[model samples]
Target chain A: MAVPEVLLQSGVSSLLNSINSVIQSLGVSVLLPIIIFLIALAFRVDVLKAARSSILIGIGFIGINLVIGLFSENISPLAQQMVEVTGITLPAVDVGWPAAAAIAFGIAELGVWMIPLFVAMNLVLFAIGFTYTLNVDIWNYWHFAFIGGLVYMSTNNWLYSVAVGLTLGLFVLVAADWTQPAVEETFDTPGISIPHGTSAPYAVAAIPIHWAVDKTPLGNIEADPDAIQDRFGILGEPIFVGLAIGLVIGIAAYSNALFVAESWYAILTAGISFAAVMHILPMMVGILMEGLTPLSESIRNFMTSRFEDRDMAIGLDSAILIGHESVIASSLLIVPIAIVMSIILPGNDVLWGIDLATFPFFFALMVPIMNGNIVKMVVTGTILLIPLHYISSAVAPLLTQAAGSAGFDLAGRGLITSPVADAGSPATGVLALIPAPVALAVGLVIVLGIWVALRMWPQRMYMVAGASEEKARETVERRHTGKGGGLLPNKLGSSADVTAAEGRSDD
Target chain B: MTTKNILVVCGTSVATSTVVKEALKEKLPERGLDIGTIAKAKATEAPGKVSSGNFDLIVTTTQLNQDKFDIPVIHTTAFMTGIGQDEVLDDIAAALED
Candidate 1:
């Protein structure tokens, strides 16, 4: 039901205005930590500890935002300059994840209801034993909103938007449960699972492909960074690789630099910047994880105390997992590849504007799915992102429309494209390209399939996480014993023992 | 007196290395090991990095090509997982003494 125009005029408008003002004034960095603190208090955490964790979480967000800001500050201009120099107008300006979030939250029709609706949905699911991932990363709800806004645009019905949004939430919760075992096993992070907007859907897409890849003789080959280093030596180091890729992108981006000196400067700066980004971004991730540790611990304690039989997984931002080596290496390598994809892929109309920050977010799960195989990740990442360009290009018109409706001033900009929302997000593309009713029907099938899968093969659903525990132990042992050089080891154990240990998530 | 150089390697040289770096900073002084330059690099970068033959020891959480690095290499997920940390520290001290 559409909220009446008169009601929107009165107390509702004033209330939402007041809330938005407060949110805008305090900034997300300040607001999010405070919210976390309040949530911790509600959980009956000790005041001092809660306060510390909240502040630290806030600081972590600030650090991440600052790094993103730094990255965008350097790269966004380079991207725009590339467009200007190359005269390659792709018909959509890639506003990126942050701008996409702004468009999402700014929509009163969607933003006003997303949090309450999802929280209620989460509770209902948990009560019914459908999902165990307590999704506390409310800030990322924009991802859901982005999809709903598209559905709404397609159907011209607010109800469809709400339905799709709620459905997406339900899907993510199920996806979280399905992937938890892998998360727990792989990252050695026992109590947490990622229900991140970008990673979960990609995880679903990657599953069958990974299965297929494993079937091929290519599956017998192991090509993680360590293996690649063993094979290619210096070319395998992320720094050198990033340098070479960045130089190519920089030269291409600055192809029309007027002076020879200016062109050289551009090439050198881009090379160094890409190298620095690959190196430093993980440090920022480390800081972010440090802040989250206390809160995760407290929540783990509180939940375990309540449900002793259950091993609850706290769903967090996918950013936490990106600190891994394969994730960083894959994302860094794919940066140039994405640029090349945009240039070479025929019928592609998106110039991959400012959404460059979303690359690491994109690879959050793919790296793990590839089992830390850098070679496989790049191959899969390229294949996965290729279709996204077309998908995002198709949705660019609707996205721009939604942004315009959300009170954004896009008077001059011709067509705005969101790399993440368009093709970058598998979920959004599914919602945008398919008719609303058909999409909803398909969504139902998938959700039901996932639910049944969770019931029948709860252990198998999280196989990635299952293998992680062994991987972790082996990694520690091999590294400690100085037995590092060789082809990648096969799946360590044949027994059902490790999968039995994965039985902890049965609750 | 030669100042020993230590290279701390993690897969990304980010999260795990930070923890390992902190652990070394705390333990090395107590173990009577004077640190010179403690640097960080990705595990994949270890071979090319150490090829200069500059560092005295390599501490990493990921597997590396140990034969390529002439220096003593110690592998422990101790900093991240808190398992076998003492053995790692003891080895670090022994390597430094050597």
Candidate 2:
């Protein structure tokens, strides 16, 4: 059964061309779901369920993209206006996460094999009891690929890129595990973990920093968003807070316009736009969640059943985690801080633009470390941004080079763009710069040290008291079951209660 | 039948409020209640908005300080997770009827 070598080569080339054509025609929105469906089939999930889940994921991505689009459209103008009014010209324009992800996905060397390889690695890690997270946010695989692509370009070697990428991915999974308990405690939800590209690693630094802050006299001062809301009334609400901040930014952005006869309302209009964003973005997220929940639920259920003895969490996007009021409020506070830091923080050249909209996402994990205290969260977030801006500036050249290799034309625009514009700030500045093996070893040691420290002094790291988690669950259940306010009808006890009950008992 | 004004509140008064508002729209009509205006506010806005304006009921996802509000406050976590939704609607119906 000998086949000619030339014919085999031709057949292989044709098959690759066909895949490339399909990918080009459909793009990620359509291609991702199809890939998910095929993977689901490979996993032996029921055809109908797999198809439903795939379609749901596609819808979720679409919903998320629409929301992001709306947010960018609304926020970008104000950011631009602010830069114009202030005369703050930075050398680099942050192309933000979408562009960065595009560059990562466009890398020909990592094409098609990325998700499958990562999944295989995840399964191996799971089987070996190395990680509790089953990473389902396949779309975000670009983060790892981005690192790999960067390494490959730098060294002109595929092995280095692959090594760095896989190492970074594994490190994120471990970080997800490390932060899960705090996420559950802070958010008061269970059965999920966030392994987002940028925010997850920041949590490692945040934990130690927050611990230090707790020792200060400020520790007793609980200025959380909820507390602020209760105390300050309207000023504390995200909408009003957004309005006030937006007004300041608008006035600063349009100072010249304001002095002119026709543009007096520009500042007020800016405030209204920001206020509208406060209302609109979350609703969009809610819509996106409606699509994501079904998929996460199916995955969670399957994993829970499969791993009967062990507690398993489906790792999802940070978008799922950012819906908390405190997180949003804290992020709103950070926006102006980030802007101020960008200007005053020496050696920073990246201009704030579309990426400012991602502040809520950036602070999602940090809120937990601060125990949802807005005051502490703001302080820590502000301090974090100092390094972030510098690192973003530092990586501009590499990012610009990568953009060129990936086909983004920067020669004509007079602006270099950094992919680290949003999520990769911590990565470039901290872990990603190190040699792969060294980074992996250091990451593991630090994680282990923190893990041990958490075990020894659970309260120090914002670990929930055992009794409180139970109490919280009971409170939720009692309210649902008609023992408390009985807000829920008696018969259809919610899936939330069932899940809460399951989580509480398992612990 | 007198027109009833219901105020729905959540953490940010955006995402969950929209969901709750939509849910109440369907449920309130099902209960055969005459509804006038359905409004949404952040939980912080409840005290001022509730005190200044005449509202029949306040439905919130977050637990509110009922003593500060003159109107009945119904607290439910149903809006965020879409769980225990029937109970939340039933409770809303009961609050409106009362």
Candidate that would win on TM-score: 2
Question: In model 1, where do residues sit more than 4 Å from their true spots?
Answer: A1-30, A45-78, A90-127, A132-169, A176-197, A210-225, A230-246, A253-259, A270-293, A311-337, A349-380, A392-423, A431-441, A454-507, B1-98
- How high is the lDDT of residue A329 in model 2? 69
lDDT of 1 at A26: 70
lDDT of 2 at A410: 41
Determine the TM-score of chain B of model 1: 0.90
Candidate 1: clashing pairs of residues = A181-A465, A182-A464, A182-A465, A185-A465, A185-A468, A185-A469, A186-A468
Query: Model 2, range A1-507, lDDT digits (tens) per residue?
Result: 356887899899999999878666665556656766776666566778677766764664454455444544544565566677787656666655655655565455563346667777776676655666777666556678777766666666777677667766776786776566667666655655666676776666666667777788777776556554355556655567557756776677777777685454767776776676555554543433333333433443444455555446567566545546676567656766776777787777876543564665567777656667777777776767777787777666666666555444344343444423333456655545666567556755765665444333323232332124454444333322442211212223234433444456644
Interface RMSD of 1: 6.5
Restricting to chain A, the TM-score for each candidate equals: 0.66, 0.65
- Candidate 1, residue A59: lDDT: 63
Computed on C-alpha atoms, the DockQ of candidate 1 is 0.17
